[model samples]
Target chain A: MPEMVNLKINDISVSVEAGSTILDAAKKANIKIPTLCHHEDLCIAGNCRVCVVEQKGVNALKASCATPAEENMEIFTNTNKVREARKTIIGLLLSEHNNDCLHCYKNGNCELQSMAKDYLVDSDKYISILKNYEIDRSSPSIIKDDSKCIRCQRCVRTCAELQDVNALAVSGKGSEMKISTFMEKPMDYVVCTNCGQCVTHCPTGALVEKNYIDEVWDVLNDPSKHVVVQTAPAVRVGLGEAVGLDAGKSYTGKMVTALKMLGFDAVFDTNFSADLTILEEGTELLTRLKDKIENKKDVALPQFTSCSPGWIKYIEHEFPDILDYLSTCKSPQQMLGPLAKTYYAKSMGIDPKDMVVVSIMPCTAKKFEANRPEMYSSGYKDVDYVITTREFGRMIQQAGIDFETLKDSECDSILGKHTGAGVIFGATGGVMEAALRTAYEIITGREVPFSNLEVTPVRGLEGVKEATIKIEGCKAEWKFLENVELKVAVAHGLSNARPLAAQVQNGESPYHFIEIMACPGGCIAGGGQPMPVNNNIRKKRTEAIYNEDESLQLRKSHENPEVKRIYEDFLEKPLGHKSHELLHTTYTKRKKY
Target chain B: MTEINIVKDAVKKHGRKRESLMPVLQEIVKQENYLSEERLMEIAKEFDLSSAEVYGVATFYSFLPVKPMGENVIKVCQTIVCDMKGKEAVLDAIKDKLNIVPGQTSADGKFSLMAVNCIGQCSNAPAMLVNDKPYINLTYENVVKIIDEYQS
Candidate 1:
């Protein structure tokens, strides 16, 4: 339906759609042009001139990533002049970059390092002009090292365009310019949501997740300590990409096997607590609806899901007025932490003091969430040593374990069981689907009217999705009314969430429940997932999540055996006293700065 | 009016648009001599932008400083023309006179010294500006006397 543009690169004819970049046309002809600041998930940033190519009859080289391909245009990708300019640019960037690769966290995986090796730049040709900047390790989630930055502005663009949380900006100008928070304050002191998208997008070692590998290794080695690890739903799908496996593959059995081999006394699943979250959150939603409809009392409708720590912190800072609208449920990671120290430890006859709870998550914000002052409800820190999925993969490599050769293993009992509803929490609209699967049955005594228990409307990578279900044939405890429409909405990424939140703040929202994830594709494409995340990678992870859901025997959270047992033996009921003390929390307002 | 009122008034004069940020910041610098953290935050709220964004624009220009300054800011040109014409000696003289190096304020809160790029007075080499009033073709004695007159 659209017009096409024909171009010749390296003397090979290629045709691409009109308005496509030279980079796109080159890709169609199988010509690889390397770039540093060009990200598939972000807008075009032509600051890095690494993708320059020669256009015939043009005096100057054009940045291929930013220049649109034209009809019958002749472009040379690997000409001698282009290569020399790229090499010179690489050398110039390295002149200011801290080249202490041995001490850098992103040594082997850094994009700039790979480019430098490919171009074979002379590192010593230019004198070292690296500025002396103290690495800011203030936040528990990420480290900001300005000495290694290349000023590509990819992180700056990601913070502004993708998340709409401009916590980082290019301050100063020219040679003195650097990315900084307000007034160059420490990261934790600012209004950072601690999402770590900047860490994933940074091409160098400028930003990285703070490592707790040594601390985790210590606990595993201590004889008196009992180490237990929990893997989040997204980790199973994302960990594969880090360990040389392709995306869209579930590494659950192998991941559990690797954790067991890494000396964890018990390996559990965060999905078990995710199922628990459905019960508590669903009950709270029903209670609010009852208060508003039956009791004629004012209650915050369109209750927001609180499973994402980054979203929790974002709302606390940017939308403090809507804190009452947020569900009081702690994230599944936090829910499992206190329960592990109390219920699991007591049941397993282990002392709470000896049990060290470690979480393998797809989020960096979980580290910040675990470090909050109020997370000590379990008497000890609820969760200790939160490591990202990438860090876990590194631990497997550090232990000299061949991940592909490991046999599949099942998780430990009590906290290891889960359901399809819980596993789908990795994707954007997953929690809404999971909650509807349970809440509809509770209200109408019937399963959600969907095929194979898959809610199709709320699925995929759309930024915002809305659905409505007409409650019909309800069981009458005392019927307020029947055939009421239950409207729900789902949103991912904080940029999409800000408008929905404003609607709620203005008392003009039309939905009864809202699900928001701070990351683009929810936890599967989280900030702490493998680097170089793109639409293709996010799609692969999302499909793998649904594939995992289809492969499970139990499709509903209420049907999870472990969840039923927990409610019967310990929790007693949803939103009960025991559950409230352990599984829910309050939020604090933060400065907008 | 309070400092926050000055920021609000500037925003009112320049209007709350993205392109108006520069003029608002320049107006603030004209009145307060420097942009403060509180004033930046106030402007951010008025414009519905983030504090980092406002601060980024404020700090990008050397003429609009984010840090507090003394009674008078003395910007010594460090461009090629001035550097070639014995700007270093004049800078050292100012440092000795005020007992402070570049990027620092004097103890008496009278002068803050900074090495800036070209002030566009290349014909008058070894130039300096105290509060936008240029003293061109300077020497160590000229800079010393200038600091003495401003110190009082």
Candidate 2:
């Protein structure tokens, strides 16, 4: 353990770990120091200047978040000078901010709103200097409202440090300081992964997940509607946190009950569709491998997994030339949407137009994805509405449901049945594991050798991982001289994804298969999950997802009965004509603006 | 390579949306020096929109420039980068030599003066971009000399 340091905060004696910042010491001592840019998960960026506190001997107040605590140092946390400084800071920030919190997506929950109230800032002290900047709504997943920005730099730090996607950065300075990316390009065109981590860390409404809650409400309120809700696996582990449940505590049953209380006719699980995705994707991989064995035709080499919308959009914009490498399977959310409006609707004897499919996802990008024109497959809109796990929790609260004592329940049938493989889709390396399970079994016509089913190569939180597996009794060996080696790589986050993608683009990549998830730790740490999920909570959430996977009866995608039924009835076979028409889509060349 | 394609495809798909005209204009300007009439028409058609609508939207945003530009578009950081590092002197030197304000094109159309907020290259203050290539640690004399290389 590190040496300890003693500090006096507000005249109260405090001891903290050596190298701890004044802010950390204050937090330990229960001395509240309001901050905006200083997220624990990210590096200290003293841009907000809101956490300024007085040091007894220092001439000027210093930002506690960036200043280290000196031994025996005296700090005045709530002195008149500190209070006035904080009040002035809040007043200036609010003067330039939009001040539309009543109608903003982050109304009661916004940190800026609470801070203003905390400091009792009622007047616009710096209104004259507030620049009337234009709003940039160019991106689908994010909205850039400069008027609401306090120049906190939380978004920039989260994008750069946490996700390793340095898309946002502090631009300008002082009164004109704001966030922008590469010449103020719209986020959709930049290297932004649309992971929404910035939204979670944003202290103000300047950055927010583009809200589709009203659209969902409208869809649900229609009298002729047969609303169906599907939730991603990640949502089950964290949705309860939004309703005051502890983070990483699996609320699968409570979540189902909450959705039912929200008036949805059925509560389905995206895991079922995830299982279906693995089945189709795994089958596609095997067929491609078999095709390579016979040397019949040129199959798409190095088929990349396409279950992440963030990764999908990323590949479409940043790596369109390698579209062939991407698997045709839509993300589980999209897959479930189309299936609910088509297969589930038919089974329920409901009209596709009357059926409204909503997905409670742990991804903000899904809001943009649901509105995509290419997602329509059933000759009608596939998913009618999309809501984040956070938004769903709000709706649960707005309905006055007591989540703590809610009865546990199971998901509806048909679109609800899923395998353990599908449940693990929330965590990093899960897609790779699920695919391997199905691929090994499909090729050998039997279960894999290891019951543990751990593919160590794709099992960690590393930016990029690689492994090569040899098929027993396979003869297709061009790269390995008569021995077939199944090479694979897994990458999480766009920053790390960039170099790996460049390797593939430059034709220097040696791997035959690749899995990419835009968010670090996959959907378990999605952009739309509960905020303030530190390392501890994330690890717990990931553990919960994997635990759910381990406890399931069917741990392979091929074992899902619904997937088997889909292949038997409508799809016929993986990558067949109907599958191509309904499940696959193409990409377009985009401008860099 | 895959990253580049992802960027390209996202731009292509979202660029075609009517609401994404600003981003489309930004993308076009980033790739090609300016938004050409043909490109504007292409975008308008893709969005099932009128070229006037597209042009109006593009012109409305200060970020989007409309004319064909020089081989290199030099964006001098005027917001804070140049301000902290004496951007006024550099701007004055460029204006004296080129005879144009921040929004004007040079008489020979060899350069266009535009003020950018910040380039995130604050470590090397007084940054100016030649096309998309950022040159930092700039002085008034160095900026003039750098612009001279593109004069003709």
Candidate 3:
């Protein structure tokens, strides 16, 4: 066992790991030290001086987050000088801050606002120097209001650390500092994946999702238009947190009821399209494998999953050369968009133009994904409006619907019906596991070798996970792969995707398929999921997704009757002409920045 | 050699490490006057640095401007020590001479004035740097003389 260091925090003795920070020791001693810049998931940014504490013998107050607790150290978490320093820092931060918390989206949820309240820093104690900055509403996914920024560097770190898409940077010196894109380009013009990872980590209203709730309200209010809403699998698990429900609690029924109360004509599930994606993506992978095995053709192995719009955009910008490696399947959000407009509309005897398909995603990137010009293969624009899970929550609240008290309701038939495989698509390594279930069953005509089909190797929150499956006892068609070791890798966060993509590009990759989710822990911990998101919360959300997958009756995509029926009635086969035209889409190579 | 090639050569000279970032950016700024967005992005890739990391340092240093600069750059120290020695008068003279405020460049591209931090010329209280060349013990007359030299 590691030698523990003993320290006294607030007159209470504490023993912690040798290198534990003073904040950690204080936490152990149950002495609450409020911190603004400290996040459980991010590296220690000691920039925010709110957590400064008085040390008995030290000359100056120490930042508890960055300072390590030494043996026999006497620390005072609550002291007059410490309180003064914190209040002064908060007051100074407020003085320079563009304060319109009354109308701010992060009014109640803001860390700075809460800290000011905690320290009773209501009155401005310093000379107020307000700076005006232009609000960037260029990207469909997210907005950057620099006027409200605190220069905490959370967004900067999130963009760089979590996503490896350094779309955000602190520009200007000292007092004139601001976070901006390279060359100070508009959000859409830069290589920003539009993943709201930055926004989720932002302590203020500086970065936020581009709101379409009002637009959604307008479409919902339109009597002539049929506004149908589809919720992504991740939304079911993550929506709970927004509506005061505990994390890891699946709220499918109540959420559907809430959406109905919000005046959605037909509440659908993106899960159906997720199941459809597995079918198409799986077939594409098998076909590619067969071509390489038989024709000896140079096909890109390690077919990367394209369910994540942020990951898609990242590959487009960073690894443009390996664009072909990406599976041509549109995200479940995009797929449901066209299907709602055409297939669902035609069956419901409504005009496709009159039907507005709205996707409630756990991603900001979905907004950008839905607006892609290539998604308009259904004659009319496929998906009309895209709203995040948070936006959906706001709509529910705006509609005066009691989310907690609402009775559980089921989604409308056809597009709403899905398998457990579809539900698990929200979690990392889920797509790979789901694809394996379908592929192994199709090829071997047997259940996936794993008990309960958990595929334990691929599951969890590791940045990069590799699993090898033995293709044993395959059918005659796939005889070439009999007893062949099929390797696969799963990566979440674009930072993780970078190395995987590079390996594939450089021909150093040793896998048959790769699954990449742009957000940290997949859609469950998506940029648009909830506020105050971290690793523990992500784990809870992941558990909820896994729980949801396990609770569902049908766990395999091929077993999804609606998906089967859609194939039999409309698309006919995976990778078919109609499927290619409607379900699958192409990618554009962006400038490598 | 082409401008892009020259930049690439400078990148090679500096080496593709984080420490080399400052030198690479400085050289680019020296050659290109200011770092372009596209060029910054290119340098980001060449150095394996994030655009944010590159922009952070590039923007933090006033000398390495992210925007276009005037042909002749003027930096006046505005620290307390410099202020006590009539740096403000020299600043006023430069502003009046150039017909611009600090942080603004003259329309003619002759002079760009900036009130910057101290250059450690405490012995000679007021100090300024003209195009990276330091000028010490400045008076309003000397400041005007320096601005006149740049006007030519």
Candidate 4:
């Protein structure tokens, strides 16, 4: 369908589509060109000259990343000159980079290290010109260590382009060049969402999830402490990729077993509270809808989901005026944190103080979320420590547990039970579909007519999607002439979310409810989900999430007996006194700067 | 009147895009000597940029200082030509006379000293700038004399 450009790469003629880079053409010709600055999701930085090649007439070595293929162009990918230039550039990068590869967090998994291995960099001919920079661990989530940075600008592009946060940028020039925040302020003082996408995309250990592994080990070793761990819905689908399983493989059972082996006294699922969130959030949405439709009261329509801490922070800082539209529920991670400390601890007869709650989240922001001043509703830090899936994977390896050999196991009781609806929260549009499944049944007194209760229209890797569900049949007492088309919209990634939030802010939004996940492709493709995330990986994970949902016997959140029991035992009712005290939270505005 | 209005005017003159940020800051630097954190915030707002983005750009250029500059900035040339012309002696003379190192400003806030590589004055051999006005082809005695003249 597109015009093809014929090019001779390494003396092999190849026809690539017009505008394909020399790298792409080279790949078509079975030539592998190494690159450090080129990322699948970011623009061609061309800063790393590792991919330099010889063009027929060009005097200088051409950067294949930024150079587009042309008709009849002769490109040499593995020329001696090209190789030497690449080695020189890599040597320069090595000179600047701290060579503490033996103990670096990204040692085995790093892209640059793999390239250095491929090129067989034998010597550091240049003197080390590494400038010492103090590691910034002020932010609860990410650690910024510029000493290992290669100045690739991948994180800069990720923050500025994908998230639109612009919390980091290329600050200095030449030898003193480094990535920094506003006035080089500490991360806490700046407007960083603490999403950890930067960490996900970083080629080296320059940026990483703050290590709570030591602290976790300390708490685990304590004889008096009861360590309870909850795995986020996104973690099951993502953790597989880290443990040598195919991306998007369902390893939930193995993950739970690993947590047990790691000495987490009780292994819980955030999905339990994810289902709990639906009960509270769905009830709140219906109440607001009742206020608007039945009482004609002033209420914020198109109520936003509060399940993502990054989205919560974005709205807090950028769109503070529409904070009223955000559901007052804490994120499922935050909800489970408090409940594990209070509800689960109380029922188990353990002192809430003695119980240490840790959440294995598909988010770095969860680390920040756990430390919020308001999360102390349980009389202590609700979640004692939060580790990312990446960190958990490391712990599993550290304990020498063969994840592949571990038998499938279920989560511990009390805060363990989860429904299919709860499991679907990993992907974008999942919560909306889950809520619709329950909300429609609650209003109609019948199951959703759709087969498998899979709302196909709401599911996918699309950035933004909207659907209208016509409430046709209804129960007697609630019948106000049913046939109402409930308008709803789903968006993943904050760039897509900003417009949707604006529409609601301007009173221009027509939908009654909206679902927004901050990271692209929801928690499954979250900033902290997996390394080297791409569209293909997200699609794979999305399929797995849906597969997980479809495989479960209980598909709807309302049907989760654990949720019903929690309400009957402690919560009493959704959006009631205890729910408001524990599950719901208020957000304060933050300065945009 | 507000210094921000002048900064806003500079923003207007520099074409009001993110690309114009450095130039706008440069103009503001010409007016206000250096960028303050508050002015950087204002420039960020005016350019519709993030504080980190604007601040990063501000810090990238060596000529633009993020902190306040002294009334008089003294440049001591440390280029090859000036080094051959006994630049270290002249530097020591100025240091002893002004009682300040290369990075520090004088106690009275009158002078800031920097040992710059070159100011495009290779022809002038041992040229230096005491507030952009070159004192070229200088001797160590002349360096001391120049500092005394400025101090008085």
Q: Write the per-residue lDDT of candidate 3 for residues A495-520, one digit (tens) a residue.
A: 89989999998999999999999998
Q: What is the Cα-based lDDT of residue A89 in candidate 3?
A: 92
Model 2, span A1-593: residue lDDT tens: 78999999998899998899999999998988999878887788887688999998788999999999999999988888988988888887777778877888777778889988888886745764556778778777788888778777788777766665556665544444567665556766665667788887787778777767778778778889999999998998888688887876788888889888878899899999889888778877777766765666787778888888878777776677888888878888888887787777887899998888888899988877877889888878888777888888888888899998999998888889889899888888889888888877666554555558866667667778887877674333322223567788888876667777788888888877888888877888888988766667878898888788888888998889878888787778777876777676665554322
Q: List the residue pairs that clash in candidate 1.
A: none
lDDT of candidate 1 over A1-593, digit per residue (tens): 89999989999999999999999999999999999989988899898999999999998999999999999999999999999999999999999999999889998999999999999998579998989999999999999999999999999898998789999999988889999899899999988898988988999999999989999999999999999999999999999888878898898899999999999999999999999999999999999988888999999998999999999999999999889999999999999999999999999999999999999999999999999887888888999989999999999999999998899999998899999999999999999999999998998888999988889989988889999998888879526537789999999988889989999989999999999999998999898899779889999999999999999989899999999999999999999999989999999988785
Estimated TM-score for each candidate: 0.98, 0.76, 0.98, 0.94
Model 4 Cα displacement at A3 (Å)? 1.2
Model 2 reproduces what portion of true contacts? 0.00
**Runs in model 4 with CA error above 4 Å?**
A447-451, A476-483, B1-15, B75-96, B99-102, B114-149
lDDT of 4 by residue, A84-192 (tens): 8877888888888888999998899898888777777757488888887898989999999999999999999999877888899888676677898888789987888
Q: At residue A543, what lDDT does model 2 achieve? A: 83
Can you list the residue pairs that collide in candidate 4?
none
**Interface RMSD in angstroms for candidate 3:** 1.6
Which should have the higher lDDT, number 1 or number 4?
1
Candidate order by lDDT, decreasing, is 1, 3, 4, 2
lDDT of each: 0.92, 0.78, 0.89, 0.87
Q: Residue A275 in candidate 2 has what lDDT?
A: 90
Top lDDT hit: 1
On TM-score, the stronger of 2 and 3 is 3
